[model samples]
Target chain A: MKQSAKLNTVNKWWQYETTASQKWFQFGLKDLYYNRGLILRFTRRDLLASYQQTVIGPFWIFLQPLLTALVYLIVFGRFAKMPTDGIPPILFYLAGSTIWSFFFDSLNGTMYTFISNTHIFNKVYFPRLVVPMSIILTQAVRLGIQLVLFALIYVFYYFIFHTASPSKILLLLPLLVLLTAGFAFGLGLLISIITAKYRDLDNILQFFLRLFMFATPVVYPASIIPDKYQALFWLNPLTPIIETFRAAFVENGKIPYYPLAIAGIEIFFLISLGLLLFKKRELDVMDSI
Target chain B: MRELVLKAENISKYYRLGLIGSSSLKQDLQNLFVKSRDGLTVEDPQHIWALKDVDFELHAGEVIGIVGRNGSGKSTLLKILSRIARPTTGSVRWKGKISSLLEIGTGFHAELTGRENIFLNGQILGLSNAEVKTRFDEIVAFSGIERFLDTPVKRYSSGMYVRLAFSVAAHLRSDILIIDEVLAVGDIEFQLKCIAKMKEISRLDGKAILFVSHDMQTIRNLCTTGIYLEKGRIKLIGDPPKAIAGYLNLDTQLSKHTYSSPHEAPGNSYIKIKRAELENSTIIHFEFWYTAEGNENLSIGIMLYNDLGQCVFDLASAPTRMENGLIKGACTLPENFLNEGQYVLSIAFIGDQSKLLFDFADCLNFNVQDNGKNLRWYGKRVGIVRPEFPIQLLNIDRDGAI
Candidate 1:
C-alpha cells in the first residue's frame, strides 16, 4: 500500500537511498554526537576487559613503554652506539618510545574495528564510527598512564643530570599529541576498510607498521639521519610529529615549525578522506566481514 | 489516522557467490577492468539476489511478523531495514529511530560484570545513561538476576545471560523495534514474559514492531499483520491468520511417506513411524514399529488439521499391546464426511490414554477430493466437515390432517 507522496516529510525520517552520489560524505557526525554516551560505554568496556584477566592488570600500561625503552637503550644506545644528541640515553629513548607508543597503540586498537566488532555491527544500528572512536579513547587513556611514567622518569633525569629542559615549544605538546592521534585514526580507518574485504591485509599491515617505525625516528634522534636523506625522510607525516614532541621536552631536537604545520594539514586531509571512505564502506563492510 | 513509522520501496540485495572476503586479488582487479555483456563494469555470473522488490509499510502500534523458509531473504530484509547492510538497489524511508535485536545481548562482554553489561548493552541499543538508569531496577527485576549483578556474565548460566540481554532490549525506548527470533531463547516462562512485554509495548506505548519468527503460535498471538516471503519476494501479506496459512501451505509437502525407512523415521527409541500414508480414497493407513520395552497400553492418536492450522478432528484407536515389530493401524474416514480440501495429519503416541509418549506434527498431508455428487446443490458445501444425514420430506396439512 502506497501512501500519499505529500505525507513524505523529510526532516524526521532516515532515508536510505541506493545512489552513491547523494550524501556520500555525511560522516554521521550528528549521529555520532547523539550517541556519545554509547562511545563512553564502549570505551569503558574495552578498558575494563583488556585488564580483566591479567595477573598484574593495568600495570601493563606503564610497563610496555618502560620495557621498550630499556630494549632500545641496550640495542641502539649501548650496542650500536647511536647518539642521543648529548642527552641521557635512557631519558632520550623513554621520551621517544612513550610518544611513539601512543601512536602505535591507537593504530593497533582502531585498525581492526570492523572485523572485531562485526558481531555487534551485524545486529545493532548506531553510529559505526563510535567503535573506532571508543578504541581511540581507550588507547588515549592508556597513553595517559604511560605519560605518568614518562613524567616520573623525566623528573628523575632532570634533577640528577640537568640534561633536559622544557622548551617554549612545550606549549605545543597537546597539539603534537593531537596530530599523532589524528594520523593514526586516519590510517586505522583506511586500513580497516581495506581489511574488511581483504583479510590478508592485516598480516601485511602489521609488518609494514613495524617497518614504518624505523622511518619515523622513534628509537633514534632525527639528527642521526644523514643530510642527503633528510628531505625524503621529512616526507613521512610522522617524522615531524615525533621530532616536535621530543623537541618540546628535551630541547635538543629541532622544532621544524614549517614541517609541523605541513604535517598538520596532511593529517587533517587524511582524516577527512578516512571519514568519507569509512562512512561509505560502513554499510557494505558488514556483509564481507 | 495512525502515523506511518516505516516505508520500504523496491529494496533488493545482491550477493556475490563463492568466497566473498577471501576472493583473489587478481579476480578483483579483473572485475574492476572488464566490461560485462551489458557494458556495465560488473560481470559476476555467480550471484544471487537475496532480496528483490520487497515493499511494505508499517504504521504506529502495528506489529508485523515475517515468515519464510531459510535463505528466503528474511535476514537480508531485516539487515537493510536496520541499516546493518545497504541494499543493492531502491530505498527505505522511515520516521523515528529503529532498534533491532537481531540477537539477544549483541555486544555483551563475557568478562564484564552483569551490572556493567547492562549499561553497555543498553547504550548499544540506543539508550542514554539517564534512560538506562531510570529503568535499571525494572530491567534487573525482570531478568531476576539481581543476585549476580556484580558477577561477570561468563559465570551466569546460559539462561541467565539470555534473560539479562532480553531484559535490556525490552526496556529500549524507540519508535520501531526489529526483532528476529530472540524470543526463541530462554525458558518457556521467560518467553511468555517477553511475549507479554512485547504486546504491552505495542499496545500501551504505541511502538511499531517488525518481528521475524518461525514460531506460528507466537506469530498468531503477537502480530496484527503478517508477511510471508518466498524465494526473495513477498508472496502474501494480510491478517495474521491468512498469512500464516499461506506460509504453512507453502511449507507442506505431499510426501506419501515422510521417511523411507523405519530407521530414519521421526521418533524416539521406544516408538517410530514406519509408514504413514493415505490409502484408497478415505482410509488412512500407518505402521508404527514399537519396541517391547514400551508400556503395554500404548494407544495411537491422529489429529487432522486444515490449511488454516485449525484442527478438524482428533481421534485415537483403542489401547493395545505393541510387539517388538511393525504393527499395522488403519482408520477409515467415512466418505463425504471431510470437506474437500488439503489436510495435515499428526500422530501422537499415548500411554494408557493419559500421558503423551511422543507427538509428531504435520507428518503427512492429503487432499480430500470434491468428487462426491450432490444432486440438490450445484455449488460446494461449506463447513469444517461435510456429512450427509438421511432427510425425509413431509408436507404439513392445512389443519394437522397429514
Candidate 2:
C-alpha cells in the first residue's frame, strides 16, 4: 500500500565541499557582538565590586593605583635606588606598574577561565571564548584609568619643569597598548585552554608566570638585561610588548620595529592558536569536567 | 511523510576513574579485553557497551524520550547530541542547529538584574540580540515576572529564578531541542507549562526534540517514541508505551536481583530498612539486576531499623493507596517517619502491621535518601509525607459535599 516504503523513494545525494577559513572568526565575532550586553554588565559589576561600599566610590580606581604608585616611587625608586631613567620616580614607576598590571591581570584571570567559570559552562553553551575575552576587555578599562593618570602627571610636570612633553609619536601609544593586550590575551587564552583539559598544567603555569614577571620589563627596563641576553629577551613575548609601550611613551616615543614585528606575529599566532585549541576542547570538555 | 532528521550511531565514552585519569588494575584489565575485542567496553563485565552501538533515526517533529537508570548513559547521549561533549566512538548526525538546555539559569549572572540576565541567558543559549529582543516580551510574559524585571536575579525568589531561566531557554531558535531533566525544576503549574511549551515547540515548529527525564508521566505525555538504556547501552527503542514498559520492567527481571536492604536493623525511633531482590530470591546489587511482581502488596517493601539492630516498622503504602487511585504499582516511603539520623532501611514489600509480603532481609545496607530543601524541592520528590494526624477540632465550618 505504501509502495514498498523506502524502495518507492530512492534519493540521490550530493556532497558539498567548501573551505571555511573565516568561519571560526565569524563565529567568534558574532558571539562577541551578541553577548556585548553581558560584557557590559560584567564591566559594571567589576566597577561596583571595587567600590561598592567605599566612601569615595568608583574614584577608588585612580586613588588606589595612585597611592600604590606613590608608595613604590618612595620605597623602591628613591629609597632603594631602583633605577628610574631620567623621568621622575613617580611617573616612571606609575607608568610601568599600570601597564604591567593590565598584562598580569588578563593573564592570571584568563588562566582560571575554565575552573572559575565551570559553573556557567556546566549549565549553558555559550562560546567559552567570551569568558576570557570579556575579562581582558574589562581590565582594559582599568588600564585606561591609569592612562588618564599618566596624562595628568604629564601636565603637572609640564607646568612645574616645562621639560615633560610627550613626543608626537605618543600617538602610537594606543597601538602599543592594544598590541600588549593582544599578546596577553592570546597567551592567557592559550594557557587556559591547555589547563582545562589537563589541570596539572595549571600548577606549572602559576610557577611559570611568576618567573615570567622577571623575564619581562615590568619592574625594570629591558636594557638591564646584558647584551648577550638581550636576544633572549626577544624570546619572551611580553618583552617587545612592554618595551614598545614604554619606548613610545616613557622613552623616545618610537617603536623598535624588528622585535615589535616578532611580538606582533607571536601575538596573532597565539590568539588564533588559542581559539583553535579552545574550540577543540569545547567539543566535549563538559564531559571530562 | 516526515523526513528522518537525526541519527546517532554506536557512540561510547570511556572515562578514567582515579585522580588525573589513573585507572586501576581491574579497570585496566577490563579495558585490555575490550580493546583487544575492538568494541567491548562496558560498565558491566557481562555487558559490553557504554551505549552499545546505539542506533536511532528521529523523524521531523518527533518527540523522543530517553529513559535510563543511573549511569545508563542518558545524560551522555544528550551531551553528545548537544555538542557539549563528544563520544569516544561513533557519530551523531542531525539536520539542523541544536540548542541543549541541560540546566536552566546556568549562565545567568547573579549580580545582573532579571532583564539584564535575560539578555545574557539568551545569548548563552545561542540567540542573537535582535532575536532575543523580539522574543523578549513573550519570554517575560511567559515567566510572569514583569514587575521584578529590573531587580537583580539574586533577589528573586527561587521560583522566579527558575521561571526566568526557563523562559530564556524555551525561546531559543534552534530546530533541534535537547532538554535534560529541566522539568524536574519549578512548581507543578510551571513544570506543566514548560512541558506544554516543549510539546508545542516540537509539534508546531516541526522540531526534533530529544527529551531526557525520569518522570514516566511526562515522558508518556510528550514523546512519540522512547528508548530504554541500561549501563550505557540501548535496551529498547520503539513506541513510547513499549519502551517505557521495557524500562519499567527491566529492574523487575534480573537473574541475580541486587538491592540495598538493611542487614541487621534496629527497632523504631529513627528506624530504616530496605530489601531489594530479583523474584522470590535474595538480592545482591553488585552482582546482578532484580525483578518483582505481586498482589496489592507486591512492591518494594521497606522496614525501619533502629539502633538495636532490628526492624521495628514495616509498611507498604504505595500499592494500598494505588488500589483505589491512579498509581497502580509503586514503591514509596513516607517522609515523616524518616528521622534525622543514620538508620538502615530494609527493602521489602509489606502491608500494615509488618505483614511480610516478601521478607528477604540482609540484602544491602541502605541509608535514608537525602532530600535537599534548596532548588530541588520542585522535583517529583516534594510533599512525600502523607501523614494522617488526628487533630483536636478547633473551629471549622464544614462546607463540603457540593
| Candidate that scores best on lDDT | 1
Q: All candidates' lDDT scores?
A: 0.82, 0.66
Q: Can you write out model 2's per-residue Cα lDDT over B266-285, one digit (the tens) per residue?
A: 22212232323332122222
lDDT of 2 by residue, A1-289 (tens): 1111222353221111011111232334554565676666556555555564478876877876688788887787767777755666677667777877788888888877877877766655556777777788878988898789878987898789875457665676777788878877878877876676667667778898778777877667777688998997877776766666565445455567788788778788998887776665654555445
Q: Is the docking of candidate 2 incorrect, acceptable, medium or high quality?
A: acceptable
Candidate 2 lands at a TM-score of 0.72
Per-residue lDDT of candidate 1, residues B1-402 (tens digit): 798888888888888876777865787777666644333335456778888889999999999999876678999899888888888777777777788889999899999999999999999899999999999999999999999999999999999999999999999868999999888889989999999999999999999999998778899999999999988999999998778877667356654665567778878876788777877547777877777455568898988877554578889989886667777888888887877777777789887788677787667777777766755665557787888777898877768863
Model 2's i-RMS, to one decimal, reads 6.5
Task: Give each prediction's root-mean-square deviation over alpha carbons.
Answer: 14.3, 11.6
Each prediction's TM-score versus the true structure = 0.78, 0.72
Task: Give candidate 1's TM-score.
Answer: 0.78
- Which candidate number maximizes DockQ? 1
Q: Where does candidate 2 stray beyond 4 Å?
A: A1-57, A249-254, A284-286, B20-49, B250-402
